[model samples]
Target: INEDSYGVDDEEEFHELDMTGRVIANNYRIESKLGAGSFGQVYLCEHVRTHEQWAMKIESHAMNNNPQLSIE
Candidate 1:
């Protein structure tokens, strides 16, 4: 799902605040952003199935080093 689909504003929405506690993809629960660089944002997602969380990173430098930027 697109982040804008949720109607979240950039200024009003802060990654740290949102990452505090929230669920995404109706399955992967957001734990936190492991790190954020020029590439993109990396988040720690928890799999609802096995309750196992993994590091999911998204970048926006398409055609470069990283691609696909994710906002949450």
Candidate 2:
């Protein structure tokens, strides 16, 4: 897997905060950015307590109108 971690620099930190708002479900913390596209961005996240990791995708609603897909 790509090991290029993020949030260590200013630009990445800004993206991290903007995309994830720090953490989700009060359990996962974003570790790095994986990829991005017109839809939005994907991230590498870790469980705060268990340290387990997973990939997360955050889609920008403003980037798409009358979407064909949704996470739910």
Candidate 3:
């Protein structure tokens, strides 16, 4: 996908903490980093069954503490 389509300024925004390992949430397994920010990281994931590509944005501790930064 084009970089502009994701609306991310840089790939660095998607860095994940070493302690934060891959997780399966809502039946989706996070594959890799797609993009990120101070609040969270967007992961490139796939459907276990359908094998479809999808993006999953996970909130970080810093973001959860700050109520102002919210995704609409």
Candidate 1 residue 48 C-alpha distance from true site, Å: 1.9
For candidate 2, the 10 contiguous residues with the lowest summed lDDT are 1-10
All candidates in order of TM-score, best leading: 2, 3, 1
lDDT of 2: 0.62
The candidate, 1 or 2, that scores higher on lDDT is 2
Alpha-carbon runs more than 4 Å astray in model 1: 5-18, 59-72
Ranking by lDDT: 2, 3, 1
Question: lDDT per model, in order?
Answer: 0.55, 0.62, 0.56
lDDT of 2 at 39: 59
The true-versus-predicted C-alpha distance at residue 34 of model 1, in Å, is 0.6
| Residue pairs in collision within model 1 | none
- Residue-wise C-alpha lDDT for candidate 2, range 1-72, written one tens digit per residue: 212333334434434444443677688788878887655578889999999999987654443453553432
- Give the runs in model 2 whose Cα sits over 4 Å from its true position: 1-21, 63-66
